[model samples]
Target: MLFISAITFGADYDSIGDSTIVRKRSDLTQKLYDTLLSIKGNGIFFGMQHATGYGVGWQNNNDSCDIEKVTGDYPAFAGWGASVTDCNIAQGEGFEDARYKIKLFHDMGGFNTMEWHADNPFGGNCYWERRHDKTKDVVASILPGGEKHQEFLTQLDNIASFFNSLIDDDGKKIPIIFRPWHEHTGAWFWWGKGNCSKEDYISLWQFTVNYLSDEKGVDNLLYAYSPAKNDSREEYLYGYPGDEYIDVLGQDNYYDLRQDATNMPRFVKMLETLVSIANEKNKPAALTETGAFTIDAKATMPEDNWFTEKLLKLIMYNDKTRQISYAMVWRNGSTSHFHVPYPGHPAVPDFIDFYNHPYTIFMSDMEKYRTKNE
Candidate 1:
């Protein structure tokens, strides 16, 4: 019921075959559609940053399993990773001087969905930015919702408008792989900071889906629900919108031996649990975010290497699985530099071997959604 069998071509997506909505320029929309198709059946949707504006092209690279896949950017640092841009022009080349820049990413191989963020589930106040308490910053809400709640709605509306405009090459809607409020189970980000109650967060999520599809009339979307490893609350992992609202289920794991105790058991278990739930619900699952610190952390090599080997094999195999569809390894060289050097990993390592073997056989061919290598 929840699992919808799908094949990602490029990025082109039409209204459930029978809806009428003026999408964005057909050319751009189609390119995205094809891109989705290219990786649809596969288990990995390698991520790119929406923060940095686009370059001429994008690449996934060999370090992680993504390997040199071209990438692009949205207007300004506006990847669905966070919240959408403000120009308020959420979608495309809307002819607005566009306070919102529309060219953030490069069109390397191009992509399927134009992911932008509305607001993170973590709270509005971030540690780095917008540290001001929501009570202090946003004007009080006049309507039923609180002021901060109202502001979140505005951001959500703006984002809806942006994604709703995508059109296929033949003047159809470009379906998006919408992964919003992702990684909410973790407390690092603002939304998951313990301020938002489960009910409140759920309201926010439900309201977002209602407004985006029902009110905004954006049909080109395949919602994805992702949670971070070592979730602070189990509700965050289970609090997904109904099947109609979600398409893929995934988890984010970054704690390697270099960071956490020993690899990402919590993350692996998180996936195992998620897969069981997804199976019950019928939706497919994926390793949406995964990576070992290429740099280095406290852990030394053999142990860390052991972690990687065990980790890769653990999630990539076993009975509970057969649910994983893709695995996107985060190999952002810049990111590796940004974080403290992973102790053992002064240099980032490549997952090409992992991807090349059983761990990734499903990539080239999506016939069986099982861990290829063990």
Candidate 2:
């Protein structure tokens, strides 16, 4: 009952009333969804954002430092950003390029999660440049009857088209955890706290889900809402849209590499809050994004086993927090913005141990678990 039987089409989702049709939401997606709902408090999956799509050694090339490329086993989930989906491109890397990556990642036996960095439709302003004074006005414009509503609709059309294009060799649309307007609690993006009112933000989120799922008939998506950092329950769900619109509740945090002591305790307490919320709502929770950025690769990389020593221990140490379905690290754009270490990097040994640990579930492990569950 947690999932529904779905059919996918290579052409368009809404125009699939005739002719041969492939299951758009494959049985594999159902298995993954069912497994996520059932694995609470028992185990957790390891994931990486843009792992194979790009990395330190390679940028959209054959030599990326992806989980499988480095360790020969893919991660449980692969994260991607939908920045360029607005400019008629699927994402930053380009339409065809991103399509190839998504297809390959899903075919390699990994789940997909995508986030968006939507440009300001009102003034055509970018995410980095903000005008808090115009935040409310911008929010109003995106509403159903707002002046800029048509532009917003155009953006969603392109995004829905791209998501529908993520087909496997069998021509099945890959299921995705579509996380739009993420990190809204942070004040960096146009849709952040200061940019829009809580009510308006919630409206935007609900509208997005409705337009995509109902209007466009994009049925292969599970909506996820992720906020940046918050200490208490109220702070975390300050602008929460509602339980109906959200399938997964997630959070993103970054461990400071400069500090000698790790923030595992704080993270544990926060996880406790997340677990409580998820249990109450009867939905899965995930550490959607976490990492140590701007590492001084030359300075011996402090606390080499940060993956096993800190991140993993956070979930293992607490009983309730272990309910998290997955924990994903950020991308390794370059030497400076890297999260996971490479083959020759100092943290490889520790990461290998983390990957081998029984509690950790990589892509292969997920397949094995799915088989057992089935």
Candidate 3:
């Protein structure tokens, strides 16, 4: 219910695109989209997954973030995992922890995005558990008439309850970018390409959106569809639900972007195609999840300035790719599996340069840009 007068839109319509499904979005959700649209081509907001929830040597500390320690400014965007709420076995904290962190980040003038690595509905350990029984299609089993349809609904009910709990001090719902079933192009999760048929994937996406928006009445959200690296745009859109059910166009590329300098062109071209699709659809695009898996001195790489020389160069490679609204790195879980630079890591100097770059927007930069645009 927190409406920004400067970015007001018709209450009954979506201003970003011709998506009727987004017509009933909350005021703050619409305003957030408008803000993203306003600053799309100007600068790319830097983001870190699980920024405030935990870090290299700390966990559950409200006042700690690896990015903040290194750059003196929080990321413009914060990525969170909703898998804990859905599966209770994935990479995020509990519901109350997520609610508190999300509200705190929003109150500090930062954007929030969440992804759900939902557990396999048909009996599995976690989202990564693939079934050996090729006779049954997991996605098919969870569709409208499938055997596990009700179980899927129960999981969605948990998700809706968690999203509904994201309230601010004024008791208004805090809008968030909900990204479920992400990285589907990869074959790691149950919803991956090889595990589910294209029709089933699309159906699952549409069903989730309809259930959350229409049945569950969860309207304070902007849905994002992100797939892992793809060979072509056709491959990327192979399982796309539709324009009406999607608000953001995002792609996750860690293999191409984090590799040597030779692969930088491929990453840039991939982003160009993604941005073109977003432009054609009139929606904001983002590098939803990326980053080197481990950025230590012993890690393999071309140069020491991974943040500036590699990541930043690829992002600034072409005008099309540069139009990305934001680029979010993966989480900083521990010393070996972290993404952002810690206090005395060798990547700190280049990270500072990356943070100081004109095209990179942090929290303070976003606030200033929004104020000026308003």
Candidate topping lDDT: 3
The parts of candidate 1 lying over 4 Å away from their true place are 1-66, 69-130, 134-144, 148-150, 231-238, 256-260, 294-311, 331-349, 358-374
Better of 1 and 2 by lDDT: 2
Task: Summarize candidate 2's per-residue lDDT along 88-150 as a digit string, tens digits.
Answer: 343223667777667766776667788887767654544636553454467668889998788
What are the models' TM-scores?
Answer: 0.61, 0.84, 0.88
Clashes (candidate 3): 0
Model 3 pairs whose backbones collide: none
Query: lDDT tens digits, residues 99-216, model 3?
Result: 7778877888777998887766655633545555657688898899999888888878878887877777867788899898888988888888888888899999988988887788
lDDT of 2: 0.73
For each candidate, what is the lDDT? 0.44, 0.73, 0.78
When 2 and 3 are scored with lDDT, the better candidate is: 3
- Candidate number achieving the greatest TM-score relative to the actual structure: 3
Q: Which ten-residue region of model 1 has the weakest summed lDDT?
A: 70-79
Superpose all Cα atoms of candidate 2 onto the true structure and report the RMSD in Å to 1 decimal: 6.6
TM-score of 1: 0.61
Q: How much lDDT does candidate 1 score?
A: 0.44
Q: Lowest-lDDT window of 10 residues in candidate 2? A: 5-14
